[model samples]
Target chain A: MNAIGVDVGGTKIAAAVVSPEGEILNEVRYPTQAIPPNRLVRTIADTITEAKGDFEVGGACVAAPGFVSSAENKVIFAPNLHEIEDIRLDRELGSATGLRITVENDANAAAWGEFRFGAGREFDHQVFITLGTGVGGGVITHGVLLRGAQGAGGELGHVTIDPDGPRCGCGNHGCLEALASGTAIGRRAREVANERPRSALGRLAIDRQVLGEDVTRLASEGDEAALQVLDETGRWLGIGLAGFVNVFNPEVVAVGGGAARAGEFILEPARREVHLRARSPSRDLVRIKEATLGPASGVLGAAALARGEDGEYVLGPSKRVT
Target chain B: MNAIGVDVGGTKIAAAVVSPEGEILNEVRYPTQAIPPNRLVRTIADTITEAKGDFEVGGACVAAPGFVSSAENKVIFAPNLHEIEDIRLDRELGSATGLRITVENDANAAAWGEFRFGAGREFDHQVFITLGTGVGGGVITHGVLLRGAQGAGGELGHVTIDPDGPRCGCGNHGCLEALASGTAIGRRAREVANERPRSALGRLAIDRQVLGEDVTRLASEGDEAALQVLDETGRWLGIGLAGFVNVFNPEVVAVGGGAARAGEFILEPARREVHLRARSPSRDLVRIKEATLGPASGVLGAAALARGEDGEYVLGPSKRVT
Candidate 1:
């Protein structure tokens, strides 16, 4: 049976009707700016209803950004999309689309997407980390999603790598998110750019605000200043990842999201750090690589997570699906 | 049916015949200091044979310290015990004791003990940390022990908390083991003693080396310097635990071993740090408490891990057994 996966993000809403093989049968998208605050829920429901078309969909899952309570099927907090927070998304969407629905953290959905169809398709254990505006993560161990008590497990970005280094949005000091996220990259780029005023990154900073994309682009252009910034970001990312390698012992660490576009620039340093920090066998066995599905992973993963009226995964666990 | 468990440590060889309900039907112990290097394997077999008595034992497991390969059933590296490394303990001991044997990391076995019969008895998700000469840990998520690829997973103590703070035994800087272990407590106690020369801890340091237990004893006696050392130790421990809380999202983090004897002195501050660093719902729900099982956890947990001819837990997973 086909299932619908809706990715409700801060910028846009993406919905796709996906087959059990992870193929996108039909897809639809709407910019978040086009929908009114009160219309958000209805818009999401309409998007899913449209995406399914005549695919004989059994269920759907909405991947939202924030603290999601998977057991309750509700979003506890979504600083970016407050319209869905504290609401019974499953019930609301179920009534609107006539399909059973579940909500999940977008990162978790993306991770599952990679696990099922992309980088982690071959491994039983995986750690998927997305470096976007914020660092978000999801973990799978022993073929099951590691949703901890209350379904809040796998908050990987908030771990402290340097206790006194920097203040984070979560009100903690030196969280991995504060040091490795796109926001962190931009912040570090500015600092490095100022120190090296003759570099491409430094000249770009003088003209306008240097964003994470600018840093990646400048690094790709061989700017020493920007290279140093991304390199440091990779170092910080690896510091956090070394802990994961030691803790989860995953076979693949799929680095995704907007910043992962930096590719080997960030991954190379992270791998080196993991080699230095994580113990043998675990560190030696793990492969830190880029996530393959890109933005569509959200829909692919959410659809895979969708459960039917029979109460089993519509798409099934990938390990057993084949 | 009962199962045999062997705890081969640097100090002693403790073996037990444990019932399916976690009861010790028979037990025996021999000091490692008494055995010659060549006789170590034979002595372990003798201990298992002596401990079983009249019990109908199924399978057995040996909980050893250091890096273990559960799949290979061999100890790769054990700083404290070199005699057993790289040997086929299952084959060697099975031939002698006539029971199928498996090898596991000691900390992992203790964690399973705590999860099955101690503080984490009620929870499916648990993080068990032992604060001894060095910090070691094991995790249970979704009722399965997290042994990473090649079985080196759950090396919790080696996670780097501060990149440049202190060099660890694994050659990393600012590892949780370097900061929060009994060795770390002793090291910090010495440093604090020098800074507060008029305090009780300082006065004691003048007479001899201030050990981790001495700090705990002085703190219990209301010494400010000793209290500061434990409080600081707790703070560092909490920083590391906060990461575990976020990463594992466990219901309870059971703290065991020598330094945990300080109890609330270390726990209270560690809890405070977790509250400050960890996210909501997870931080709110987790209970960080002293592990109830003590030294017996090693033998008890290894016994529980013993597999039958059916390849199932001799005692079964606690959640299923009930």
Candidate 2:
């Protein structure tokens, strides 16, 4: 079977034709313009049209960066894309593309992709964390995605490591995202560099503003300040993961996103903390690994959603005509 | 239909004949001996026999401690009851009692009891926490119990709150149970008394050993030392609950434990911490309430398990009984 998966990001929209095994056959990308919801729907439809020229689309699924309600096609809330709030993406896209469309939270779609075709392929219960500009997470329990009562479950990044540490974008204090996210890492790196002018990171920051990658690069190069920041962030991430392990007792945890690219520098310490803190039996069974799908996970997972299959993106007959 | 519910605890076994609507028609109790697993099964059968004279018992369910298997009747591991490890509770009890039987973890049963007939009746997604010598928890998502891949998913107490604080029986450090359980609170009170002789708690402890209840009583009386211990424990509990809120995003959190008898003194602080820590959308929807089923929750929950109704302990019917 085949499917079309659309990944809606802040700046661009990418659509791809995916096989049942999650192989991408054809792809199309376009800049996401700051237009009304109706126009945005047309652009997404056009992208799907472009991808359909080479491969038959069975079903279409869209991964939106926000609270996508499963019971309805509406985007309840997308902080980065505020204008799309409550827009019926599924209905609009289905009308434009002339195919059935399903919408899901981007993180959940990515997690579904990983569970079916990436790092979590072998596990029945898994958690996928994407450590990008802000942290996002998806949970699959007993091989079923957990959408909660209001399609608002699996918000792992908001689990607090310190109740009094810092204010978070979600109006919480000391959330894991506020401490360990790529955005958090960069913010801390910049603040520390300014505070400690003699440090190596400070000298590097003289040329450009510090980014999450720069901090990871500096930590790898043996910068004490940078390493300390990464270590602290890893500890907090471990704390959060430990809590998840206790609650879900998942078989595996797949770490994705730009920050996870640091590999052991972040994952090693995080695993150590999880071992030191998580309960036995369940903790012993959990394995931490990097996500395998890379950037394509969202689209593939969304495609699975459209197909209504048990795993990452399901394809249907309607999409085949595309 | 009427069903038999048996709550197997460390000291006593409580059985009840429950109506479909959750009303108890009659009940019986027996002391639980440290006997072999088969004998324990026999004891459960005898209790059911005693209760059968009063009501039309259609099915029987036993709620045991430790990790229940996917089959519900099989006990994967019961560290507290070593002899029961790997025992097929349903088959043994059903054969002996001449009735259909089901088995489940005690916490899951209790949570189900609460969800179907007690405090959580109004919510589709709920979390139940029972605090005693240890912390036990159960999760219900969209009205279904989440018995992860191993049926050992809801180990809420095992989540880490302090990475370096204390060693838990589960071989992890700084677990919520190690820091917030009744045993942990009492232990801390004793340690404080020993270290600070002039403190009020120290004076109270000069006469004899301290109990969790005594510490709670002292804290309620404005004893500063006792208050600190409870406050600290409450904070840790809140931190763990915050993680739960993020993952489950349940509409209700029902707390039932000996420690919860402290009421608002403990619950208010825990709620404050969870509210300050969990993400916005989930935090706004969550309501923390004390468990309302009291001592009967276990047996009632177990009964719900037997009926194979909508609760945590979901069990399959025995072919022989049918």
Measured by TM-score, the strongest candidate is: 1
Q: Which stretches of candidate 2 lie over 4 Å from their true place?
A: A33-38, A53-58, A187-207, A215-232, A307-313, A316-322, B33-38, B53-55, B166-171, B187-210, B215-233, B307-322
lDDT of 1 by residue, B257-303 (tens): 99999999999999999999999989999999999989989998999
Docking class of 1: medium
Which ten residues in a row are the worst by lDDT in model 1 chain B? B313-322
Off-target runs (Cα >4 Å) in candidate 1 are: A320-322, B320-322
For model 2, residues B56-164, the per-residue Cα lDDT tens digits are 7678888888887746567777765665677777677777877777778889889988988888887788889987898989988766677766677788888766667
lDDT tens digits by residue: candidate 2, A160-190: 6665777888777778888889999898888
TM-score of chain A of each: 0.97, 0.92
Highest-scoring model, DockQ: 1
Q: Model 1 over residues A1-322: C-alpha lDDT tens digits? A: 8899999998899999999999999999999999987999999999998887778998999999878988899999888688888999999999999999988888889999999999999998999999998899999887778788777889999999999988999999999999999999999998988999999999998999999999989889999999999999999999999999998888999999999999999999999999999988788899999999998999999999999999888987456210
CA error at residue A248 for candidate 1, angstroms: 1.3
Alpha carbon lDDT of residue A196, candidate 1? Answer: 92
TM-score of 1: 0.96
